[model samples]
Each structure stands twice: as C-alpha cells, then as structure tokens.
Target: MDVPFDLNSYVRVLKLASTPSWEEFSRVALIAGAGVALVGLLGFVIFLLMSFVPGAGL
Candidate 1:
C-alpha cells in the first residue's frame, strides 16, 4: 500500500490567510456585496408596487 503525501499548497494558502491585509479586503468585499443586495431588493419591491397600481404604464 502506498499513500501520496504533499501539503505545500495548503501551507502556502494558510500563510497567506494569516495576513491582516487579506482580512481587511475580505471585510470590504462583504460590505460591498451586502450593499448591492440591498439595492437590488429595494428596486424589486418598487417594481412590484408599481405593477400593482392600476393604470400604471408597464
């Protein structure tokens, strides 16, 4: 029986993950994504409301 053994890539990723810059960038990305989602939901609700009003142009 023979088992393959190699973890260099995993170790490199782990090391990169420990940097503070990576954490800050991740936070920024999360906030940006949340903002985009909020805007999209708000727009969808507005469209739904507009559709319900009688005589409104489609």
Candidate 2:
C-alpha cells in the first residue's frame, strides 16, 4: 500500500528552509563566538592549574 503525502507538512518544511536575514545571522554569529570564547577561556584556566601541579610537566 502507498503512503499518502501531507501538503500541510510539506508547506511547513518549505517555509522553514528559507535563508536567514542579516540581523538573525549576526545574532547567531555573536552567540556562537561568545560560546567559543568561553570554552577557550576555560581550557586556558585548566592548563594554568595543571602547570602548578608538581607531577604535571610544564
């Protein structure tokens, strides 16, 4: 038996596939950059802490 297609769902999918406006794109970029910066800062702090340990090689 063949499955029936739903037009409403198809239309919704198409609507969501459109490109983002500049403002939306910029906002996403800013958020992503902040996330990356936070991860980098955390890694640096961990590295510094490890360096102070006696057994850890510099």
TM-score of each: 0.58, 0.66
Clashes of 1: 0
Model 2 lDDT per residue over 1-58, tens place:
3334577677779988989999999999999999999999999988988998887865
lDDT (10s digit) by residue, model 1, range 7-58: 7666777888764598898999999999999999999998988899877746
Count of backbone collisions in candidate 2: 0
| Whole-model lDDT, model 1 | 0.82
lDDT of 1 at 55: 77
RMSD of each: 5.5, 3.6
The TM-score measured for candidate 2 stands at: 0.66
**Can you give the lDDT of residue 16 in candidate 2?**
88
Off by over 4 Å in 2: 1-15, 56-58
